[model samples]
Structures are given as structure tokens and as C-alpha cells.
Target: MTVFRLIITLLATSILGATEGVVTSNSVRLTDGETLASAMDKGALALNMGDVTFIAGYRQVTSIRQDPIIMRFDGQGSDAVKTWQRTDIDATAVDSRAVGLIWDGYERLYVLITVDGGSNDAGTVRRFTNNGWLRDYGSGGGPKVTVALRVDPNTGTPDTGTYIRARLSNGNTNSAVPTAIAFHGDTLVVQLSSFFSPLRVDRQRMTHDTGPSPFPWRVVFDPSLANARRSEAVNFDGVVDIPELPSRQVRLMVGDHEDASATVIVNQTVVARPSGSILDSGIYDPAAPCSFQLHDSIPSSLQ
Candidate 1:
């Protein structure tokens, strides 16, 4: 039997602090002060709606307190193109179950929702970004849920756009466990189990299982690189440092912005990937809350 050992190493690049990235929450008071003409409490889709706000949660069938809401923009100024709010849709390249609507630019409004919630697990992620509606991520079968899909002009069309995730498989929520997530070169160093030495997964495109469903796992492989970022932080007097030696996956809840230092809570979870396989474009489907692999750049040694 030929045993293959793959090594991944994320260099020790200490980021100054947490950078500006998208975070998930139940409700948000639009600080923009832009009073929407009307607001509906749908699900997570409410965030992308135009001239609208406050989407209500009708069928939040999950125990999690923070449920996703969908918002919609009425068809007043739109170029006669936009999904109708507070209405049901059929399975198509545009709107339906397992399908969604991702707002692209001035001429784009995507609708991603799933129609067949059964074994087929068919879903679509289509949008009108530049000029017409296009398929971004199609799903055959996997975890399904509607989430606020946030992306830039480049990632607006799905197909591994910005590498979105519902949750981090290797995360920390424990007070006693000390965790760390450091970026080295282009790789991400996930240190856990001090005695076992720090483990690293090379920069690759992989999918992470982060949905309201049962199966939750992290998948990693030498896929590709889309983008990368770096951040650093300082601990306060009472702040707890790494007590257990080495670990990865630490979550911090920053308080008010005025505070010089933020409150970072050490999350306890070892992120490991048993399969080092690269993901093809067809492996992932959009409109569902399934996790996915992010193609990132890293050192060749780890690959």
C-alpha cells in the first residue's frame, strides 16, 4: 500500500486586528438611516431587497435563535426585473426553492431558492448581474437553507465566489480552551493539540459543512487561490491568552467600536481534513447553506 502524507503550513503572520468582513446575525437596524418604503420579515433574503427592510421570519424551523430573513425591493424603479416579494416561486434558472436572488449591480437582481427539498436536492443560484440571469451554483443534493449571500462584483455570480461559509468547522466556544488562527505566507496555520505539534493545511479550495442540518465537517485539499487577508490583535490585562499551548479556531466577540481592545473568546475545536481532494465546479450548489472550499494561495511545500 502506498501511503501519501500531505503537509500544509500557514506561516506565522500576525494580523494587527480583525479586518472588515461580513458576519452573520439575526436582525440588524440598518445604520444607513435609509427608511425603506416598506419592510417585510421574510428570511435571510431580506438583506438584499431594495426599497425594503425588516424581513420577518415565517418558517424559521431551526432551534438556533438567529434565523435567516429575506428582504425584497418592490418593482417601482427596477427595470421591470425583480422577483416579487411575499410570494411563492417555481423551480427555474431564476427563482424557486434552493434558489436565491443575489443583487449584482444596477441591472442585476438574483433569486436563489430550492424547489425540491427531497432526495434530488435540486437547487439553483441564478442572477442578473451584468445584463441577464445566469446560473452561479447548482445543487444536486446536500444541506439546504436560505442565507444572506454576500459577494462583491467579482463573486456575484457564484462559482466559488468569495468562498462563503455558514460556520467554521474548526471553531472555539469554550472559555477554558485556548485557540489560535495564524496566517503564514499564503497558508493558514491551525494549531491544536500542542503535544502533536501544530497542524497545517495547505492553501487550497475546500468546502466546509456549516448548515442547520446534522452533518458538519471541514473539507480541505490543494485546490486554488482566490484571495487572502491578514489581521493582528492584542490581549488586555484580564484577557486570557493561550493556556493550553497550541490550538486553532478562536472566535472573538468585539464590543462597542470605541473600545481600544475587543473581547475575543477562545473557541475549542480542532479543524482537520481527512480528504485532500480538489473540488470541481460542479461539486457545489448555490442557494443552499452548505459549506464550501475556498481556493487560496499558499506555499508549495504544504501542497
Candidate 2:
């Protein structure tokens, strides 16, 4: 009877809400010469819970050296409750910076990190649980690697079976770092500015047609980070939740376009583009009034 009671208690805690509040924002406080990975805006709380606050930013170790650090605060806000820095965990000489933070709404805190891969950036994601930093996710108990880049030779598609973060393209002019990350239900959504085409140039740099551009890439992974469900380019602005909406589906705002039209994404697969007639002429603005019509098929122009 005691063993049966223990099992029931464990199951309840596994799926129960452990915290009273969970808040996340790109706006974070920074000192002189300090910067965030990709701050959405400036001057706001990064992440706060009840009385404790967490901020992800850089610490200037020296005039030439900077390291990523997460500062925790208690009541006073004058001093840090705890400082979780990257150098404290990884002692390597490689250049790494903590860019962003994501809360699973549970006990796990995912840290979005980027390491300098020669001239470009290589993305890596790690998690902190009750047991502390998970150092055993990699080979021989190394740091956890969330973004993997391994493509098949023939098909040129990501091969999941033998994926590794170390296999990502290095020494590229363009960055392969993850710019943003958010949780879409049980799935983890990560955004990369560019992935495969390292030498890709815009219209300003006129040249022969290079390989296809795999930019604005979005990748979805399960909770365990063992399998990648899908990886492809997307047109959504960012991941957000609509408090007024009744549905529980993930809301992805699609407001980045040349015209006065915007798209909407409820699931990772479907996309809905608003009609131009319904919107006034001008560039698409997320802050403006808008509506969308769900279609069974995506327009060929967008595809």
C-alpha cells in the first residue's frame, strides 16, 4: 500500500503546475558594453517568477573578453541571488554567448546559446533542471546540443539518425545561430536566420546564382530533444499566445511582408494569408488591425 501511494504522488507532481507565475520577455536590462543575444526591444524584465527574477546577458570580463551570464535576483534587486555564467560550466576557450532563455512552464529552463564558429555563429541549446546543469547529454557527458545540422549527401536533407551539433557548417560568412526560441505546446520551436547557404548574398551583392537560401529556418523538436519532427523555412514573425482566443493552438504572427497582407499560423504545418482587399494599402504591420481567412491549400506564390 505504501508503494502504491508513492507512485500516485509521483504522477501528480509530474504534470502539476509547480510555479505560481512564469513570465518571459526579450526586453532585458544591460550595462555599458553589455548586450543580449537578440533583444526584441529594450528596458523590461527578461524573465520573472513570483519574487525571483532571471536575466540573460553578457558580462564584460575584460576589455577584450566577454562571457554570457544569467543573473538571478531576490527581494532587494541590488544584488544577485545567484549568478549562472557560461564559463563556470564550460571551461573551453571557445567563444560562446548566452542569447536567450525559455521556460518549459515546469522545472526545466532552456538556455539559448551561440558559439563563434570562425567568422559565423554556431547555435547550441542547454537545459538546467533540479539536478543542475545536464552535462551528460553529449558524448562522454558533454554539454547538451539542441540544434543539429546533418544533411544527406544525395537528398540534401537533414539526416536525423546521426545528427550532431559539431557537424554544423563552420567558417561561413553568414550566421547559423539561433536568433529566437519558444515553446509551442509540447514542442520546442527554434528560429535560425540562416543555416545551409553560408555564402548567400542579397540583391546588393550581384553575383551568379548560388545555392538555395535556407534562411528564416524553423525547427521543431520534442521535449527530450532526441528527435527533430520537422525543419524548414517559414514566414512567421514570431511565436506568441493570444489571451483572448479560445483555442489552445500555438499562435504565430505572420506580419512581415512587402505589402499590406499578413499570414497566420496555428499549427506548424498550416499557414493563412490575409486578403489584400480586406487590408488597406501599405506594408504589413502586426500592431495594426487585421483578419485572416483559413484556406485548405497555401498559395503557390508563397510556397
Candidate 3:
């Protein structure tokens, strides 16, 4: 009789353990505009919307929604990507490109807008957070800036007589002015006018060698560097190594100088070529042959 009682007790204990292990599956279907709190109130461990799913864990909602909001301007043609509207005001413009979109985890979204016209005076970046719009104006005020270079193609040897020109986004240009040119340790520097600032230039890059035989060098601008801005002249402190060759050349190209109009300047010569014609010098023939023949033909290469 005691053994029978023991068997019955064991069976009861097993049933109790089974009941404790059981869990109720709690989930809720959410609409497009439902809050997380409402889903929690429904005893939901997960919320399923049309095409999105949010999982709840540790008393927190684990899903974030990020959708690009596009605004179209009237009379701006059908190309949606190239046009934009100002969130601050109800103004419509054309050729305003949406450059970037960013979402902050809590409740903020940012949109980077670029204007195609000469001088990005109309361009603005907007932030959407806390149910309102915020505008950010980039660096616009600074002292007059100038870039100078002291370039040495190789150790103990420095080249001379380099020329440079700057093109502004407003269709204005500063031609290859000898007075505006300066040098510093194997780098050619161009002194921009007082009106031009580093913030005004959207992008900058260097081309090792690409032009005519004498100074066969060019600087190609990378559009990706548009956001990279320097308030003052860029200092070259031997950070960028120069090739130890007489034919070694370097050119600096700045794109969208003066605004977001895609203005590009080609001739910002730094470091002169070794003395001697291209035919006479084997260095020019193989080491630095002209890559940009079409641009070489144009006296003042401006685009």
C-alpha cells in the first residue's frame, strides 16, 4: 500500500511539473499606425504589421521603421530624384538633389540636399525630429585663405615655376595667377581669393601626373569628398610622400568651388617638370606621359 501511494505521488508531481512548464503564446497584430504601448497592453510578445515585424523583449520594443520621405516641387518635371522642397518653407525649386538620408534611433531623421545651380546659396540640409524641422547652415565665415606648396620631387631637389587657377561655382574664375601660387615641401599650393573659402569648394583630389609634357600632371576631384571641408589651408607636413623622380608631378583639382553648381577647375599646377623637352628626356616619355590630351589643348582648362 505504501509503494502504491508512492507511485500515485510521483504521477501527481509529474503532472504539476508539466503544467508549470506550459506557456501561453501571446502575440498581436498591429495596424500601420499603432503604438508599441498598445501592443504591450494586448499581452503581445511580438507585433506583426503588413510587411514589418516588431519583437518585444526585456520590456522594450525591438523594431525601428525607416522610410525615405520624398517631396516633389511643382513644375519641376517628372524626375523625382532631382527635385526637392524646403521643409522650413513652402518653396519649390528645380535641380535640388537629395544627397543623403539618415535616421537617429529615437526620433530624428536628416536629409542632405544639394543645389545644382552655380553657388549652393540655396542648398540646405534639414533635420526632422520631435515633430518639427531644423535647418543647418554650414561653415561660411572665416579669414581669407590661401594654399602654398614647397614641393620636392626627390630628396635635395625642388621644382619651380608652377601655375594655378581656381574656378568658382558661380561661373566666376581666378586664372592661373603667379602671385597666388606658393609651395611647401613637394606640394603645390594655390592661394584662393578672399571670396573663396574651403567650405565653398565641394570636393578636392590630387592627380599624380596627367597633362602636357612639361608639367604632365592633373588633379581629379572625387565627388564623394564633397562633404570633406577644411576651414583653413591644408598643411602638407610630409604626410603624403612624393615619388623621388624628376618627372614626378602633382596637380590639385577642386570641384564645385564656390557652391554646389558642379564647377570644376583643372589648372592648379604644383611642382615643375625637369628642364629639357619631352623628346630629349626619357623620363617624360615613359615615366609621365600625357594622359589628358584633350585638356592639355585648352589654354585655361575650365569646366
Q: Provide the RMSD of all predictions against the true structure, rounded to 1 decimal.
A: 18.6, 18.4, 31.6
Model 2: lDDT equals 0.35
Give a tens-digit lDDT track for model 2, residues 71-140: 4444334343343323332213434445555653233455554444221122222222112112222222
RMSD of 2: 18.4
Best by lDDT: 2
lDDT by residue for model 3 over 1-303, one digit each (tens)?
A: 111000001111110111011011221333323344443465534323232223221111124311111222122113212123222210122222222222211111222222222223332112111111111222221111111111121121112111122333453332211112211212222223222212222333222222221121112111121121121222221213212222222232233221111211223221222221111011122222222222234432222
Q: What lDDT score goes with residue 198 in model 1? A: 15
lDDT of 1 at 208: 21
At residue 171, candidate 2 shows an lDDT of 24
Off by over 4 Å in 2: 1-45, 62-64, 76-80, 83-87, 118-174, 197-214, 234-303
What does candidate 2 score on TM?
0.42
Using TM-score as the measure, name the better of candidate 2 and candidate 3: 2
Taking all chains together, each candidate's TM-score versus the true structure is 0.24, 0.42, 0.19
Give residue 54's error in model 2 in angstroms: 1.3
